[model samples]
Target: MDFLNKLKDITTFVFDVDGVLTDGSVFVSEETGEQTRAFNIKDGYALQLAVKLGYNVCAISGSRSKSAIHRLNSLGITEVFIGARDKTEKFKVYLEERHLKATNVLYMGDDIPDLGVIQMAGLPVCPADAAEEIKAVCEYVSPIPGGRGCARDVIEKVLKVQGKWMNAEAYSW
Candidate 1:
């Protein structure tokens, strides 16, 4: 099996929210000091499809934004973990509790804070605009930057290899 073959082995996809789901920008209101991040619709759709297909889709972020959580939860990700300082802990727990092997996981992240969790994934991935150190360590790096279609890039590759990309099941919903 080749590197691409490894993608077909993935049963779960875990993502970091800040830089992975967004462009790593924080929009804060000066009056109320409220922070918000933009999410990519393509990424959201692919994630929801993954969940609907019975793949474990999860989000782990250090951020505690109500809107972000609401959006991800709306997409059917029940394993969303916000305010996770040590994201690797959540990674391990998800695997253990699900009886999933490390090789069955694909984890995407984009910064120093996500480095440890990335290390724990069988298919460690990063966005094109990720930190240099993170890109250097990732097994696969998307050409698209975060908050764009990085999540879709990985999801497409996996689904295509697994004979599920753009299938009738994907269009049913």
Candidate 2:
């Protein structure tokens, strides 16, 4: 399949945080007013493994949630772009800075704001619960929903295709 072929060349993984990672829900603290979002542990493991395997993993979000940023940082993702007004511009800069190519990137998004990068990425994917328009543009749509194992599903597929899954590195972490 075209999607499977694209996965073979994926050197980078770009995800939109709010919907693609957090299920599009935000909980505000009563006293501090700090926002929090829950992320799937399985997804976290896949992300960490991808990072360990030398894949370029990045999170671009329109939200300014500190907790979300912290979670990603703990996963060893150094390229976290929070509060990005225009995701397309940030994505371009990211690729240019790393000397990476668009055809080697797999971008997962769940909404309209993610349209630009999704259109440009070599492989565009979405979760089952993604917006209809976003799903329409995506090359693949995982059956898993966000804040679930959607990330894990896609990441596992890519790693498996590239023979990066089920290796010693994956066994350890």
Candidate 3:
């Protein structure tokens, strides 16, 4: 309920890829030398739901991968930014491009690389298994861990508060 109030005004969600989206472990294909990441299907669904509800969802990560791009694109997220070293700067650019204010942003991250952007966001969030430093700065730490349903936890809270969760329109498929 507390988190719901904090997320009530959020219009955008920015996420860090490594520890927040994945389990912070990369599965490198020895045969093809391609990096693979495991993502949560529930998280993916929530992302699409956010987009369907007209909220901007973005991905900013230092590592780049083709599969990640394809996955996010499949969910209709066009603001995916992989190979991003300066997430805060990238986030600022996104805000300017969309004519949005920093105060309307929610950022979820889980490590040192994500600290700057997490601080810049109005509502900073982290997964349950996030680093101690990262968790310390978060406004809310999801009960679920990364690569699980962490994103779903937060998104559902916000949507439910706004009377969107479980609504017929929200479940439109």
Task: Using TM-score, give the best candidate's number.
Answer: 2
TM-score of model 2 vs. true structure: 0.98
Q: CA lDDT of each candidate? A: 0.89, 0.93, 0.86
TM-score of each: 0.95, 0.98, 0.95
The TM-score obtained by model 1 is 0.95
lDDT of 3 at 166: 79
Worst 10 residues of 1 by lDDT: 164-173
Tell me the tens digit of each residue's lDDT in model 1 across 44-82: 889989998889888998888777888898998888899
Error at 76, model 1, angstroms:
0.7
lDDT of 3 by residue, 91-147 (tens): 889889989887788899999888898888889999999999999998999999998
Tens-digit lDDT string for candidate 2 (1-173) = 48788899999999999988888999989998988999989999999999999999999999998888899999999899999999999999999999999999999999999999999999999999999999999999999998798999999999999998999999866
Say which prediction, candidate 1 or candidate 2, comes out ahead on lDDT. 2
Q: What lDDT score goes with residue 147 in model 1?
A: 93
> How many steric clashes between backbone atoms does each model show?
0, 0, 0
- The runs of at least 3 residues in candidate 2 whose Cα sits more than 4 Å from the true structure, single-residue gaps closed, are none
